[model samples]
Target: MSATVSREGNASVAGVNGPVLGDADFRFLREFVLQHCGIALSEQKRQLVQGRLLRRLRALNMKDFGSYCDLLRRDPDGEMGDLASAISTNVTSFFRESHHYDLLEKTLIPQWLAHKRRQGDRLRIWSAGCSTGEEPYALAMVLAEALEKHGAPFDAKILATDLSPQALQGAREGVYSLDKMDGISAERRRRWFLRGEGSYEGLACIHPRLRELVTIQPLNLLHDWPMAGLFDAIFCRNVVIYFDKPTKERLFSRYAKQLEPEGYLFLGHSESMHGLSDDFDLVGRTVYRKRAS
Candidate 1:
């Protein structure tokens, strides 16, 4: 369905040096994004969406939002990735929500390893919506430290996926500005990163050992997921807050199905599965364990 733009009542604000995003354009883009990515753009986000897509309009030499929307509709498969990249927020840092990592190192890993030791099973982690690389890299660091402490070879891998190809490319590159290392400890910085030099000065790259454990891929959570095995832990923090309630419920249910029995699911501090899904029991602050039925 096409959105109708009204000419009256301040329906559009003329953007700086460009065409304003009219009411109809905002409506269309919002629905399009939600339909394609399951990310609901609330009325409050109209300005934010306008600002983010302004650059795309300029890049495409489009005069207005209408043209942009038409382009998206015409070549959705080719342009959807760019639209996703434009609208997706990729703000992230190393070891964000430090308490989650603490829980991983001090509680979850120990318990998981004890059980896996008996079964000779490997650890599998999914960093859903892993923006750039920080979250998965932080997970890899924790696993690496735990493996060193255990003093035994334990097979483990982290699957880091995001919808934005641009973000995934950055994640795969595994490089970051030196300032972004603030959340990371000196010990970790020394052990897990290679400081850049010359033209690459003031940058850090994740050490090969840690990078080896993470596999980065582009994935849309709303689409068919090709993964076959259940994950021991899934880190989907700060992602579902952008989705509507039904989307959140469906996604949480999917996560529950993908998690091993008694496996953990970590959410952002602002998110919860309390009213959305019953398949998981609250085990920690914003942490849930799959109910073993």
Candidate 2:
């Protein structure tokens, strides 16, 4: 994959006119991010664009921003996602929104079970842009408890995706600092994690059992999703804060189509589908369900 991304190109910014970043430079990065990740950035965050992309400038040894932008255009295999991952914010932890998980256990899971018992359906969950695997692990904990009740096995899956390969790897490994586990309940912490042992002191690792229920993969949301069946619930969470208006519209529509009728969609509390789509109806809080058929 790295071989195809033009890593060894002859494009150099040495002695070249560099981007000084006035209105024009800011405009270039803003448009570039929108084109690449479907994220619409605020002009107020222009300082953010400068701070984030400056690393890219240094990494490529480019004399200025224009040369870096030119290099991005030439990377045939679409490594721009790597850059997007670098700039995008990632702030999530185990059960960050405990109320949502409470809803998942007390409300959503039971409803899904009732539907499954009636329709003979298998559960499907997608954690779009799952940062470091907590949502999926939390889902697994819910599913594991759900499975324990029936006294029989059921096939299920959690698809955890992110643009950052590093994040995906972290999600896959399922290890974390003890500090990140602050708000989780004692019972959940006990059940889901293996406390640090020996040389691995101070850090915790997700029990190997819970880790098996989820699959972590690299995904670029701006492109077509290579999936077939609809999902029973999608925990999109705070992932949409970076997306532009057009991207948000189309992406929600796609999620609407890919979700089972009556299936749920969870968004960041700050993210509202208000002007975006009516395909989903608000349930309690930030949770949403697809409008009945």
Candidate 3:
């Protein structure tokens, strides 16, 4: 699976101090990213990609982009996460898009819980591209509160997944600095997070209850999914902005298949499904409901 890329074009340019991403390597990387992650890197993003991936190169102790491309060609799965992480922004916060959570908390969870009251019934939510845990923990807090409020014996769980190994580790740790707590309300802060004491001051740790509700794992959305059942709702906010149109269409189609009938799909504020998907109908701001088959 090794790709043959010419290394003779390597040189410093455009203030890229380290191994400049030569044209050949850049082309290979662009295709590699699009093929594996569904992120279309345009020519305009060349310098940015070069800048961001320099850190990856430094971390891997690699001298040039050609070798890096070779590594990816040889072992794509092993290095894909780091490569994706290097190129993509994982900036996220608790309740990053409050409106989506509002819809979930106020309407969806309650309705789903009511309907799934039987002994074997279950409620499931998937946080696709759940970077650094905030999204899923926020989801957990909402689900936890709803279950407590409903006072019902029911099974509920959230699946939080991402391609970045580093981000998944952070999500698993469930710890964050005080600054990252802005989007979380004071009441939720008091209820769902524990303040780190003494030497660990200024840090917030997620409540054990939230940890119990959320299961964090490594997943690449473009790859084969192992999930067997349909989800009541899925939060894929801010993750698809990097994808091209065809990628978005394919991803949305897969999402439709993964959702329960008339299930919800939440997207980032800046994203839209207009003309990209027919499986969903826009029901709210960046909120879509799976069409009945």
Candidate 4:
């Protein structure tokens, strides 16, 4: 719920003034985040919900959590998109959970290359919940070089999406602070990042060519996915952790449908194929392949 907490006491994203969650407040948080962003907060994790949403209350100028929830309900347009953006967890970077990328580069890409070697074409992967675009941009830069080495008669494109317009804007701009790329390889760093210059110096941006390979767009994962054709791979890592199990099952099933036969699915490291479906077969840590049926 949106609360106009007193802009009092210490202030931070995690800190806010609000009535602690009681039965009604817990229900409100669960319903609100779910309706807006498809996140299902659990009873055990009620405090986590309170902490994360408190910041939003402050931003919306709601005097308390009740008023915040009221605003979400009253806004027919469902300003929940903004709230959804805030609520959705997006802690990812270029080549996160390195082993996944390692497999993509070492094993999967080679397999795709072998199958497609006879035909000159383009490779397409969708990075759902692409956040600030680093993941796709890094993929583009790295994969391009890999393709060149393989002499595959093809290029690659990464479709990056997020539910947040703010995140999408950051992705489209392809800009980053230094910390965003610490995990990137030095060679990759040199090739993909352009050093900031002058007053804007110290910041870095994805090289324009790499930026061009990724098409950034705003997308609500809980809503219709606008593109067509199955992807060669889908990198929706770390995104489903906030969604409840039912939502994860449904979302992953949708992901299975959009993937090409044998296309890859990557999830957060802590996430598992457990209780999801037999539709995907786990091939590596958090890496999955669509089952043949």
Task: Write model 4 residue lDDT over 1-92, tens digit each, in one string.
Answer: 33333333312222235555455655766776777577876787767766666777778776456666667678824565566666566666
lDDT string for model 2 (1-293, tens) is 01111223422222333334455555666787788787777888866776677777777776565566677768823656557766788888877777888898887777777768777778889999997788888888888888778666676788898888767888987888989788777897898889887877898889887877898888888877988989989999998877877889899999999999888899987988888998999987888889987
Runs with alpha carbons beyond 4 Å of true place in candidate 4: 1-26, 43-47, 76-78, 117-121, 150-155
Tell me, by TM-score, which candidate is best: 3
What's the lDDT of the predicted structure labeled candidate 2? 0.78
Pick by TM-score: 2 or 3, better one: 3
Number of the candidate with higher TM-score, 1 or 3: 3
Model 1, span 1-293: residue lDDT tens:
13334444324445455667787778888899898878888888877888889999889998678888889889886787778888877778998999999999998888888889889998999999998899999999999998888889988899999888788888998989988999999999999999888877889988999888999988889888999999999999988988888899899989989999888999999998878998998988898989998
- The per-model lDDT (C-alpha) reads 0.87, 0.78, 0.90, 0.75
What range of 10 consecutive residues in model 3 has the weakest lDDT sum? 1-10
What is the full ranking by TM-score, best candidate first?
3, 1, 2, 4
TM-score of every prediction relative to native: 0.92, 0.87, 0.94, 0.84
Model 3 quality (TM-score): 0.94
lDDT of 1: 0.87
RMSD of each: 3.5, 5.7, 3.5, 5.1
